[model samples]
Target: MALTTEASRYRPSAIWQLRLSLFMATYVLGASALYPEVFYTSALIYSHKFLVGIPVLFIGGVCCAALIHGRRQPVRYALDLAQGRWRGCLLVLLFFFASLTAFSTYKIAIPSVVPYYADNWLADVDEWLHGMPPWEIVHKLDSNNWSSVVFNSYEVIWFYQWFGTILFVSLWSDEIARIRYLCAAALTLSVLGTVLALALASVGPVYYHHFVGVDRFHGLNAALDRLDHSYMVREPAAYLLKAYQSGRPSLGGGISAMPSMHVAFAVLNAYLLSSINRWLGVLGWTFAALILYGSVFTGWHYAVDGYASIVVVSVIWWTTGRLVRE
Candidate 1:
């Protein structure tokens, strides 16, 4: 169970040091290109560093060492973890798998649009505050094409899922056995959220399409389905769509969309990050707010859908955290 202990004691071998350096290099280069203003024409030569050069180089280093050293490295590490282990790894993994499997196995025979009562309440509250003309004007000003505003919020979701999950869970978790639970929590709930998306389908209203005047991307469910089918996209978001395709068109696979899994996964990451670092928890809240906004703004979900997702994520955070503790 001494996972963190091992990492702290780890004086990285030359190969591991190289791998670590490359990983950091790739992250910096890739993230720097996110802002258009920072994109320098003079640095165009190094711009390509993110696309292939840095990431590929980093990936190559890790793969080479892990593959070449293989079992020679992780044995002492594994033996350390095996000590005082409670065998909770399998149970946690199975719990996660079973939750997903059961959800996938039996499709709920209800819902295409479970609108957010909470969002409705928020709108009302905001309006009430707006009775003061100046404040109302400000609220209105802040409420521009929120769909597009939220649409761009996808970056935070990915950051929490991939980066936070990897860094916090992988680093802070001292118990090798517990790592399995983290994985199970991450992979299973994430997959289950997607499965639930098919069953509930809370895409807000088609008025969204008419408002945006884009007839092509229709229903929230339809858009998700299309993305699922085209999982070959190089973009990481495409992989999420693919995860939704895991369960078939059975009772388990109703193609509805009540609670958004995108929200659920973000919630999971938030919990994990909070457990690892308080600062991360605060960042997660900001991230969650944007994700909630993104759903409705992008027309990918209704306000109700976004609200429902928030509720579901809250539930998921509580349930899974308990699983880890117990």
Candidate 2:
């Protein structure tokens, strides 16, 4: 994570670097036009979280840097922040929050717009590809002893990796790399998380029985029920269902599962981190593999969802890299 001399001296053009912000502005406007109530409600909900979460995340990031890199590194980091690095970081955070607001709003609107008709198709595709439902394969490998750990990795660690990568790249001195990462991330969410998800509106395996009125995943659900820490997965799934039913925009609410955003973001993190260094790349990919597995293991997604996400996100990442380099 050492800043290269070229990066330290390089200053990106304001318009070019603010591409994410501009994209988000256009997206927010478009979303508002289509779903004003959902857009505004999501904006309000996420805005509050933005105001409260930013400072806490900033402090936590600094503390972690201090603990990992020692006292002098924190001083240098603070100096960088004061020396105007914060502007870029602030823009990144704004883009991220805006993306979340837009993504969640679209996620909430998916069912109303398209309806959940892809779960059965996705399930069939998963079985066709894997010779059986992926969840069954995942369950076969699952151990009750490690269910909690896997759940936490999928739920809690995913958040940390998601936000932590944003924070890390936001502060990265490499302007081209930073812009590339940010743009790729925004595109991944907008395209894979929103557009394709809406096009292939599916409630995923966990909620398949509930939404589609079929017990297609009964064995998968039963296996989950047998897990020692099934509640970790069940509770959030229940909350999402409740929020969806209530037609309310809650924090981290909404569900569309064709292309797993968790897996997409994980893969995106892997690409960006690998560019920084080998070890980080390894760590990123490992976490991504875990997330891919957990997405099915928790019955939150079909195996094909994760598979499609990896392919689409890779293309998006590669395309964004070329754009930034240009």
Candidate 3:
């Protein structure tokens, strides 16, 4: 389906714009007071990553839009960003920045606030759900190809799909649709997800095993160690282990893992894509399932974390959907 010609003219809702601006302003003030290093570091890091990725994103968007709609569609989008409708571009950038800030706040503040780990209770919940820890089952799988697939899907593919969706919708979809996704995502990742994560903070199986001498997850540890030796590229788990070993309070170095943002974002993406088409929605959901499985397989989260994330994001998406309709 094509974006409506009238809708193509971007005009953001004043209320949402003001709300977002206020949110960012408040965050900046609070972060500067409580965590000055995180405040500046997060701003620099997120801005650098966004700016570096924009050129490739823009070129890809232009090419894809040209093939789908026509050259004029891409040209209109470029002009809107540059001069024609700069507010539209500003709105997207603000939403993105706020999203990253939300993540930064969670990563920095949670560890500083809640130093206790909840892996014991969280692991019990996981056992209640799956008769055993999900990681135990996942670690049993052969590590030759599945390991690479799941690890890469969790690490690399997720980033591409997540940012790709944001870039595509911001440039190609009408303003209403784009705003709905942003609002839904903001609530899901920034507000609801972050709150839940902070409230029930725990490092996860790998850290639990490493720090606490809990042998419940030795299977996952062995599998990850094997992958580290086997894979050509450094595995995500190895990198995370290294970070934890370093013991330095780097930006986004906090370890709170009760509710998985990976699963929350995956579910949110699935729902958003469903609005575009059922098949795409199914694909999104499937990818989300893989991410959930990967989270367990890689020992980054308990199954309960992913389960809680699904429920949380579903509620946020439904609530935001109703608000948007109103």
Candidate 4:
């Protein structure tokens, strides 16, 4: 084929942005119609949590892109970057908001779709493998203060690495092809993971312990209770419990866990980071490993949930890679 500078090649197409925005609009409207309270709550959370970063990163990306492509007068280059990279930044913002909103909406809707808890089957599968759930395997470690610290801190990977990777790819990276791949792969893995989770949703071990009287995971339950008293991880679980008890709409309170999106996103982050830089990829993989272990150790998901998520994300990543090239 042909060679071109990074600034001159592989930018996202307008048609691609148009199609993605259309899908996002449809999802937001449909989700609002189905569950107005959940949609609104999620939107509010998104606005507060992620909206501030958009402008900062967008401007930074435009300046960087302009600097990279600076072959004209300063004012002229700034205007050109505004017309090009700034526009792309806005598109990236739209895609990010849309993807996150859809994810939160589906998380809220999961309980409605699968009303009954299905952890018994998953727990059984774990037992079939080793006669005990994965958390129990780590039960001995929970006694060590550092283990609790690690498990508590491990949850940060979900937000830090996942969102950080998105911003890095969209704003800092010169690889537009990588950005497109991530955009497509994120939606694909999210939708598929939600579908699979909804098919046979479960409240997971900790929730089951508190809500359904499944005493099988007592060791894991105790560890979570201890973490609640000291660690930041307890806050989300507290919110989930309150939402479950009050039956009120809350952001990120739903508890479906058949296939762990935490693990899926971790896998996607690792894959995308690997595509760009080896050291970044290693960091991403380290975070993924922690999340893979944390998903089971904290009783948020069965061991099999993480396993299945890895497989699913791997398939989507491979498929999206090919599609981005084409």
| TM-score leader | 2
lDDT of 2 by residue, 208-292 (tens): 8888898888898889888888999989999999998898888888988889999999999999889888998999999999999
lDDT of 4: 0.69
lDDT of each: 0.41, 0.84, 0.71, 0.69
Number of residue pairs clashing in candidate 4, backbone atoms closer than 3 angstroms, sequence gap of 3 or more or interchain: 0
Top candidate when judged by lDDT against the true structure: 2
lDDT, residue 267, model 4: 83
Per-residue C-alpha lDDT of model 4 across residues 1-326, encoded as one tens digit per residue? 35555433444444454555676677667767787877787788777756787877666655655677765665677576566555556666667776677667777788777775678888889889877667877655665465555565566547766665565556543554544665555565456555787787877776777756768877666676665333455567778878777876665666677788888888887887787789989988998888887787777788888888888788877776665455
> In candidate 3, what are the lDDT values of residues 1-326, reduced to their tens digit?
25775443443444655665676566556656777766666677677766776666666755666566655576665554445334455456556765576566556677668764687888898898889767778777756678888878987899889878877766744655666777777777656456777778788886786655678876666667787433423344456556556644343455667789888889999998998899999999999999999888877788988888899889878876776555
Task: Assess every candidate by TM-score.
Answer: 0.42, 0.92, 0.84, 0.81
Off by over 4 Å in 1: 1-150, 155-160, 163-172, 176-195, 202-257
Estimate candidate 3's alpha-carbon lDDT, on a 0 to 1 scale. 0.71
Superposed on all Cα atoms, the candidates' RMSDs to the truth, in angstroms, are 16.0, 3.5, 4.4, 4.6
Q: How much does candidate 2 score in TM-score?
A: 0.92
lDDT of 4 at 11: 44
Each candidate: how many clashes?
22, 0, 0, 0
* Deviation in Å, model 3, residue 36 alpha carbon: 1.3
- Model 4 error, position 89 (Å): 2.3
Evaluate model 1: give its TM-score.
0.42
